[model samples]
Target: MDNRTNLDDYLAELGISEADESVTPPPMPDASDSAPVQEAADTDARGTLERFLRGLIARIDPELSVTVREVDDALEAEISGENAARLAGRDGRTLGAIEVIAYTVLSKQEGRGDTRVRVDIGGFRKRQADTLSKLAERLAIGVAKSGEPHELQPMPAAERRVIHIALKEHPDVMSESVGEGASRRLVIKPRHG
Candidate 1:
């Protein structure tokens, strides 16, 4: 009886294959250099973020890779490999949770002000933003043409911000958020003539 768990088989069951390049190649770490790597990570925000994301990824698949980079005022972490989508969850709830936790911990350690943290799995955030922007544009157009208010499905605060930003400069429509908590929605209204 073979008891060894095959990661490839498990990944395949999860709809991932060995041929997928989302998984990053592990670095060839020297036996003597591992401790220094850990030490160095504690000294920098970038390294700290990488370590945090790697820790989260390890919980799902020990072999999956996480990369963190400083992007503008935020620390962007990318999780690659088979289990990325699972970590991202439906509508990116899981990913958002992870980012919030990481950001909270990081802020506590370094003191909070600016520099937000974002997590992305397979460009999910970027794709979501693009989708939201396009939807906002279409809804704004509808509101402008019909002079009727267009209400979008309830979404998270971050998503609402995307819609607001997208329609902020529209000449014929204005975007606003209504409702509370999870039920909060984006509404586009025809600008008063």
Candidate 2:
């Protein structure tokens, strides 16, 4: 919520009478407000998530019903079949974009710089993660057995990070991030060298 909106709600919750309202409401903070200004902000993740979903659904596709939540250390978003395909995007890239936007908006609304909101669109991300993890495992094994470092194709940072972390604890194999931006990937090799 914006500062003005927040300040307004605070005044309302205090039950300011019409006679007392003339005394002037609290001045809303300006853009120059510092980090401590977050103290007055609303951190209600569920309520905010609900409002965001309603507004997003209204703008995106009114026919589609979207259920959104910030739960289990991730943002879980589900949309009805009416717009699932449209939201799913090409192999879920669009879904990834939606997650990014939701995380950002939620973070801003929550006044937190570090947020772990996970957005799932029609469970596409979950299923995709499983598939990518398997693929990474298979590639890692093949590269390790070949005695040659292998560079997998480019993938989103989230997917690549998953692969990197999964291979991090392996005694016989290791992973490194390479390339730039979305083009980045993982290079897996035998841990000995």
Candidate 3:
């Protein structure tokens, strides 16, 4: 049998059937609902994220600890412990993968379809953002002086956003994303008079 079939059979043996996944979810609250309702939803989303991360971290490494909190409109989760570095992998590819998975899982749950998730292991994401911002600033200065467009190394949409935001208010240069998918990158160009 295929891997998917194997997984299904495994779950069946564990008493988790496809029927268990079909429970109907409650209707979403109206936008006109009171502030307390929205606050409750936010709290529920945070609790769900925290529980999900705790289970995932236990599977990866029981020594790792996960803490989730609401940051603006997103759920920010920090994984730290003796083995937290293992989850970061090379250039944080593994951490990125986990974040994507977490987002997908949370988005599929009732009342959480719009919830955003950000997973960071050992503050890697914050450091990366800071580095990208600095790099964008330096590149913008160069483009302003040379009066030529400079293409940045291909990066994910999030990193490209960091670059774009960093230069959005610059007087002499602007940034734009080019290409598509994995090959997409940012270009810094001088503003014309």
Best by lDDT: 3
Per-residue accuracy of model 2 over 123-178 as CA lDDT, tens digit each: 67778778877877887788878979988888777788788777878777888988
Query: Over the stretch 1-193, how does candidate 3's per-residue lDDT look in tens digits?
Result: 1112122333356585542333222333355656686797787667656666765665557788888888888899999997787679999999988898677556654347677788999788889999999998888888888899999889889899988999999999998999998999999999877
* Pairs with backbone N, CA or C atoms under 3 Å apart (clashes), candidate 1: none
After superposition of all CA atoms, the RMSD between model 2 and the true structure is: 10.4
lDDT of 1 by residue, 1-193 (tens): 2221233433465585553445443332333544565344333556556655664566468767888877677778888887566668897878887788678656654454365888888778889999989988888878888999988899888899998999888899998899998899988999987
Candidate 2: global Cα-lDDT? 0.64
**What lDDT is reached at residue 167 by model 3?**
93
Deviation in Å, model 3, residue 49 alpha carbon: 1.1
All models: lDDT?
A: 0.71, 0.64, 0.75
Judged by TM-score, which candidate is best?
A: 3
Clashes of 1: 0
lDDT of 1: 0.71
**Lowest lDDT 10-residue stretch of candidate 2:** 17-26
